[model samples]
Target chain A: MTGDEACAEGALAAGCKFFGGYPITPATEIAEHIAKRLPQVGGVFIQMEDEIAAMASVLGASWAGVKSMTATSGPGFSLMLENIGLGICTETPCVVVNVQRAGPSTGLPTLGAQSDMMQARWGSHGHYEIIALSPSSPQEIFYQTITAFNLSEMYRLPVLIMTDEIIGHMSERVVIPEASEIQLFNRIKPEEKSMPYWPYIPGADGVSPMAVAGEGYRFHITGLTHDEKGYPVMSAEAHVHMVERITEKIKRNISHIIDTEGYYLEDAEIVVVSYGVSSRTSLSAVYEARSMGIKAGLLRLKTVWPFPEAILRTLASRVKGFVTVEINLGQIHLEVQRCVGGNVPTFFVGHAGGTIIPPEHVLSVLKDAF
Target chain B: MSIQSDQSDQQTHPLDDLLRKDRIPHIWCPGCGIGTAFSACLYAIKSSKLDLDHVSMVSGIGCSGRGAGYINLDSFHTTHGRAIPFATGLKLANPDLTVVVFSGDGDLFAIGGNHFIHAARRNMDLTVICVNNLNYGMTGGQVAATTPHLAKTTTTPAGNPETPFNLPLLAYASGATYVARWTILHTRDLTESIGEAIQKKGFSFIEVLAPCPVNYGRRNKLKPLDVLRIYQEKSIIKHFASPSELHLDLEKGITLGKFVDQDKPTWLDMYYKTTRKKS
Candidate 1:
């Protein structure tokens, strides 16, 4: 199966009943596949006007008590930021897949880039924690789409699957397990009926049970700084309480949310940190470094935001030097440096939009570090 | 008579009480028609007979977009110009619910113009109430797509250099099943039109010509009452007008009334039928 097909199947397995999006390059295949598949499974597929409307439609579908998703590229991702912020504020559970393409402004719609890593975190204005996953292969995208839906439902936040054009368009054999083999997470619903249910009240797990519209539970939700009752109360205290709760819900649950793959970290002198398509290249570099008898290891980040900072710190302490590989010009390297805390020397191997960092470049960085 | 008696007997209308009281010192200076237009919307919602719990009001960023947050339903204060698509998804997922989109001239017809046309073209089961204030009131009175020709606004200090759009005509052409235009002065008629639009099954667009007292009103040297008087005198019902006659004159403002009434299979109806047949 192709990566796009894998993503669509993953959404179906996760019980996504609604898919609304406008087709853009690299990501168009996801929308096309879902459009064909959704109706067969008693679901809906709506082709909206633009990326802005596409994102808004997904949010609406989610509120109607269905798992909803949309797919897009860099330009479409830029258009979706406003409504993505609304999803965060409203605590609507939905999945957004950015099959990233090269761009400052439509630089290369057909080519691949990992330029949206930072944007996925900060694109939506205001302070909030976002969950973003990076998949290295078609199989990973399929599995990660399920994880994205689970995380979105559990945390009541928008989950982003950030795939570059290369991975999104790549064809590979993917094994989709039977429905009985896959685990699905549904939104926690309130048990008591006609009771005053506060949509923003978090339980012990830092997740609030969701109540859909027409469920007969009266609840208010606002974009402004809101209290537990979901009513907007503008004050320093309310702002502090609301912002802290929103951020802390994800922050406190980092242990359960963060996922990373570490290779050859024991007694390593140098480490290579990368994610998404870059991880594949970085893995190749690690293999080359090992053959050259270099004490080098690799850390592949699966979950990008709520970034694997603590694990990076532990790896940084064990290694003498670190190298960051990415398809963009030194974006995640800053985060690597912040985590390393100047204790170890860090090097960057990066390419701008429409270019991919070769494995040799990463190997050269490992050699230079040694 | 059933609708009339229901309208009269209802005391403490839930929809009316849900509106913002502080803004009740409304920004529209006295005589501006927006208040009358807004009241019509409230009346229409009250008469829809749909469960408030099953209704979701969505608005884009504008003076009118603020209407979503002020309403008592499950409201969404979304981004600027994206209400149509948002409402589209909401209605598709839960066809039983009533979805209403409220947006201003600039927000709906300008930035959100693509969404508006496509939503109409798809014939989605949603109610879209576009309040044409002639200018972008929230952004300090810039000329909008619905601004009349030679109209004085902040952006068009002398006169609007570009041609304006006839929103109901555009919507009617785009395949909206029910399309209507009414000025704020025609309160009872506008309310009745809104009620009928709400009762209609497919995509319904009601373009209300609301007055902006602080912006367009002051610039045109017209009070809200003068704006209402202009609408009352110049406007003609679409059914009453000749097909060859243009709705608007450059000197005198355009006529307003229900322009299109057709039956088309809505997006939701088609979606369900297709899914059910497959099952």
Candidate 2:
């Protein structure tokens, strides 16, 4: 199956009952596949007027007690930023899949690029944390989409599945896990029906139990800086408390939220760090460096946000140097450098991005860093 | 009778059960007419016989957007101008729920105009209550899409150059199943219309012309009473009238009534019919 088709299946398997989307290249297939499949499983699929409405619809459906999702490329994702903030403030659980094509503005709609990594982390105009996953292949996208939904429900925020055109369009043999094998984490629900429900009061996990629309919880939700009761409180102090609750939830759960794969890091002198499609390229370069009798290893980032700072810092102390490869000019490389914090030398191998960085180029960077 | 009875000092207000009373002492200005239109909506919900537990309200940002926050049901005050799409999602996801979009003209028409036309064109099963106060009342009376031509506003200091939308005409053009216009002065009629709209299938639009006494009325030199007087004297009940004739002209006549009422298959109806094989 193609990565886009696998993404739709992943959403379906994760119990996403609603899909709101618009047609955007490299991501349209995800919408199309879900549109055909959702109704058969008693779900609803709506093609909204635009990406903004598509994102708004996803939040609305999620509040109606259904797992919901939307898919877009770079341009459409830009249009979705405002409501993504709404989802964050209101703690709405949904998944947004950005099948990244190259763009400052529609640069290469049909081609692949990992240019949207920084945008995913900080695109929404406010202080908030985000959960984003980068998958290198069709099979990984399938699993990561389900993981995205699980994290969204567990954390009560929109999770992003950031894939590129290459991975989104690539066809591969994806394993279809049985329903019993998939571990689904639903949003915690408030237990006390008779008592007054304060929607924003955090549990031990820092996530409040969600109450859906028409559930007799009679809860109020807004995009405003609100109190625990969900009433809009226009004060700087209230704003602090609200932002802290949402941001702290992800920060406190960093152990469970982050994942990384290290290949041959034991006693390696040079470490190559990359994610998504670039990780595949960097891995091949690491193998080539090994064949040439160089002590080089690759660290593949599976979850990009929350940055895996600790792992990178630990690796930085042990390795002689670090080489970061990505399709973007230097998005994740900056994070790696920040984590390394001048403990060791850090080198970058990337461009403004339309095509992939070749393994040979990564090898050169690895050789130079070594 | 219900309106007069509502004024009596009853032990508990009829809408107390449906109100978030803790959030009372609302932010509406002293002479603002949103309170009347909002009460009528609550009364309609009470009378509509739709299960209150299965009813949800959504609003965009504005003074009227606060309606959703005050309601005690499952309510959402979403981002500016996106309430229709949000309510569209809510209704489609849970087809059994009676979803209502309660917001201001600036929210529903200016910023959210595309969503309004598209939802209406699709005939989505939603009751949209637009509190049209002629300007952006919340932001100190800036010009709005529904602000009358030649009307003074903060943004239109001299006067508005743009001709205001004839709301019923727009609703009719966009294929709303039920479209009506009423002022807060016509409380009984407004309540009745909202109740009827709630029970009606497919897209229903109610444009409530309320006075923004602080921002709009102060600029236009129309006091609260003066705006109410115009609503009383200039209003003409014209049911089934051509929406094109239903423009607002305070000195001449304000055409008000149910302008369009038809039974059309809702979006969900078509979705199921097109996708499901008939037994």
Candidate 3:
């Protein structure tokens, strides 16, 4: 199966009962596959009028007590930013898949790039934390999408699956476990015995238990800075409290959320850091450098946001230097440099992004870092 | 005749249970008509006799968009101009829930016009109530899509050059199963119409003409009473009137009543019938 189809299958495995989407390149197959499969499982698949409506519908479905998602590329992702912010403020849980293609605007719709990594972190126009995962292949994307949904439900915020055109279109064998074997997480519902539910009071985890529409909860929710009762509060103090709780929830859960895989790091001197498709290239280069006795290793990032900074900071003390390889011009590289805090030099091998970064380029960077 | 009968100490308001009294006093101006129109909507919900536990309301940003926040049900105040699509998702996900999109004219037509027409065309099961005050009331009466030609607004100080949309005609053309128009002064009729629409299936729309006296009326040289007087003197109730003929003309005559009420399969009905057949 292709990565897009695997993404849909993963959503189904995660108990996503609703999908609202509009067609965009590199991501449309996720919608197409789910549209055909949802009906069989008593789920809903709505092709909304546009990307904006698609995102709004997803949020609404989530509040209706259904796990929902949507898929889009650069242009559609831009249209979805406002409502994504709404989801964040209201603390609605859903998934957004951005099968990234090359673009400042319509640059290359059919081609692959890691250019949207920064946008996924800071796209939605606010001071809040988000969870994003990048997968290198079809099998990885399938697993990562399910993980994305679980994190979204656990944190009560939207989670992003940031796969690029290459990963989305590539075909590979995806291992699907039995439904009973796949772990699933659901949003915490308010206790029915609790009369007059206050919908925004955080528990010990800094996540408020959600109350869905109907079931006589009669709770109110809005995109405004709201009180514990979900009533709008326009004061600056209210805004501070609301923003802090949402941001702190993710910040405190960093050890549980950030995922990275280390390769050939035993007594290595040169460390190459990459994610998504670029990580595949970096792995190949690491193998080639080790064959040549260059003592190079790979640090593959599976979860991009929250950036695995602590691990990188620890590695800085042991490694000689770092090489950050990506398809875009030094996005994650800036984070890599910041994490080392100028203790060690960091080199970047990338471009404005139309084609993939070749292994040879990473090998040359690895040789240079040596 | 009976001051004790109206005493707050002796009797509670019938709609108090449905209201969030702590959030009030509301932000509407002294003469603004949203209160009356909103009250009629609340009464309609009461008279519809549907399960209140299964009812939910959604609103976009505007003066009337505050309806969802004020209601004591499962309500959502969503982003500006996206209430219809949001409500569509809610209804589709949980067919048992009765979803209503209550918002203002500018929110329903200008920024949100595409969502409204598409929802109507698809015959999505929803009750959409639009309060048309002829301008963006919450934003200090900027010019709106429903603003009359040659009328004054902050954005249209030189007079509006664009002609207003005949909202009933638009709703009817967009394939709404039930379409109606009423003024805030016709509280009983509006309430009855809303109640009927809520009980009926498919996409139902009710456009309520109301006054934005502080922002719009002052700029247009009409007081709140003047607008009500025009609604009283010039409005004609003609059931099953052609929606195209129903336009707002204060100097001439304004047409009001139920324009279109037909039977059609809602989106969910077709979705189930077709998908079950395929599977």
DockQ scores of all models, one per candidate: 0.54, 0.81, 0.85
The fnat scores of all predictions, in order, read 0.68, 0.78, 0.75
Q: Write the per-residue lDDT of candidate 3 for residues A195-232, one digit (tens) a residue.
A: 89999999888899998998899999999899899999
Identify the superior model by TM-score, candidate 1 or candidate 2. Answer: 2
Is 1 or 2 the stronger prediction by lDDT?
A: 2
Q: Please provide, for model 1 over B1-279, each residue's C-alpha lDDT reduced to its tens digit, 9 standing for 90 to 100.
A: 344444553455454565644234555556556566767887788777777678778788778876776665677767788888888888889888888887788889899999999989989988899888888887778898977788899888999988988777788778898887777777888899888887788999988888888888788787777777777777777652422243665365577777788899998787777767843
| Model 1 TM | 0.92
Q: After superposing candidate 2, which stretches have Cα over 4 Å from the reference?
A: A192-194, B1-11
- For candidate 2, the lDDT comes to 0.93
Question: Which runs in model 3 stand beyond 4 Å of their true positions?
Answer: B1-11
Backbone clashes in candidate 3 total: 0
Q: Write the per-residue lDDT of candidate 1 for residues A1-370, one digit (tens) a residue.
A: 7788899999999999999989899899999999989988889998887888999999888888999999999999999999899899888999999999888988899999999999999999998899999999999999999999999999999999998888888899999899999988898987776376778888888788888866766355667677787766779999888878878889999989999998998867898899999999899989999999998888899999989899988887778988999989888899999999999899999888686678998998888775
Q: Look at candidate 1 and give me any clashing residue pairs.
A: B31-B224, B32-B224
| Candidate with the larger DockQ of 1 and 2 | 2
Ranking by DockQ: 3, 2, 1
lDDT ranking, best first? 2, 3, 1
**Candidate 3: tens digits of C-alpha lDDT, residues B1-279:** 655665464466799888888887788899899999989989989878889989999999999999999998999999999999889889888999999889999999999999999999999999999999999988888999999999999999999999999998999999999999999998899999999889889999999999999999999999999999999999999999999888688766889999999999999999999889943
Q: Candidate 3 has which clashing residue pairs, if any?
A: none
TM-score of chain B of each: 0.87, 0.95, 0.96
